[model samples]
Target: MSTIFRASRPAFRARTFFQQNASKTTRRFQSTESTTANAAPESWMQRFWKSEKGPKTVHFWAPMMKWGLVLVGVSDFARPAESLSLTQNAALTTTGIIWTRWCLIIKPKNYLLAAVNFFLGCVGVIQCSRIFMHHQAQKKLAEEVSEAKEAVKEAKDAIKHKSS
Candidate 1:
C-alpha cells in the first residue's frame, strides 16, 4: 500500500501543476496588455483585410462577382451570340470595377487593376442603364394596365346601377 501511494504521488503533483498553470493561462488571455505583448504586430494588408468594409468587398463581393463573370463568360462562349457576349462583357466590367474599388481601398493599392476596372465599369454602365430603363418602362406599363382594369370595373358598376 505504501509503494502504491508513493507511485501515485507523482501523478498528483503533475495534476496540481497543470491546474495552477491553467488559471494563469486563462488570466493571460483575458488581459489585453499581455496578449498584445505576446502577439506579433499585424501587417497593414492583414489589418485592412480584417476591417469590416474590406472583408465584405474583398471576401464576399469580389469572389461572388468574379465567379459570376466567369460563368457568364463560359456560357457566352458556348452560345456564341452577340447579345450574350455583350451581356457577359458588361457583367465582367462591373465586377472588375468593384474589384478595383476594393483593391484601391485596401493596403497596397493596385492602380492597373483599378484602371482596368474603371474602364470596364464605364462601358458596362451603359448596358446597365439600358436595362434599368427597360425595367422602369415595364413597371410603368404594369401600373397603366392595373389602372385601366380599375377604370373598366368602375364603368361596369355604374352601368349596372343605371340599369337597375
Candidate 2:
C-alpha cells in the first residue's frame, strides 16, 4: 500500500502542476492595452483601403480581374450563335452559381466576388441558350433534309414503275 501511494503521488503532483500552468496561460492572453474613445474617425476610403477584404487582398483584385471574363462573354454575343460551346458554358454557369453563393455565405461577404460570379452565371446562361437554339435549328434542318431526300427517292421509284 505504501508503494502504491508513492506511485500515485507523483501523478497527482503532475496533474496539479498542469492545472496551475493552464490557468496562468489563460490569464496571460488578456489584453494589456485599452482602446480609448478618443480615436479619430477614419474616412470611407481609408477604411476601405485598410479593410481585410479590400483592394490590398486577393479577394478584391481577383474579382476585378474576373470582370474580363464577363466582358468577353458579353462581346461574344456578336459572334454566330452556332459557335458557342454547350459544355463550356454549362461548366461556367455551375461554378459561377456555386462561387456566388459561397462568397455571400462566407464570414466576410465579398460583394465584388458575388457580382462577378453572378455576371458569369448570366453570361453562361445566355451562351447556353444560344447554343441550345442553334442545335435545335440544326436538328430540325437535318430532319427536313432527310425527309426531302426520301420524298425524291419515292418520286423516282414511282416514275421508274410507270415506265416499266
Question: What is each predicted model's overall lDDT from 0 to 1?
Answer: 0.64, 0.89
Q: Tell me the lDDT of candidate 1.
A: 0.64
Candidate 1 positional error at 91, Å: 4.0
TM-score leader: 2
Error of 1 at 32 (Å): 63
Worst 10 residues of 1 by lDDT: 76-85
lDDT of 1 at 139: 90
TM-score of 2: 0.73
Each prediction's total of clashing residue pairs, residues at least 3 apart in sequence or on different chains, is 0, 0
Best by lDDT: 2
Candidate 1 wrongly placed segments (more than 4 Å)? 1-90, 99-116
Residue 13 deviation, candidate 1, in Å?
A: 48
Candidate 2 achieves a global lDDT of 0.89
Clashing pairs in 1: none
State the lDDT of candidate 2 residue by residue for 1-164, as single tens digits: 99988876666546677788887798476566654445678889999999988889998999999999889989989999877778888998888899999999997899999999999999999999999899899999999999999999999999999999
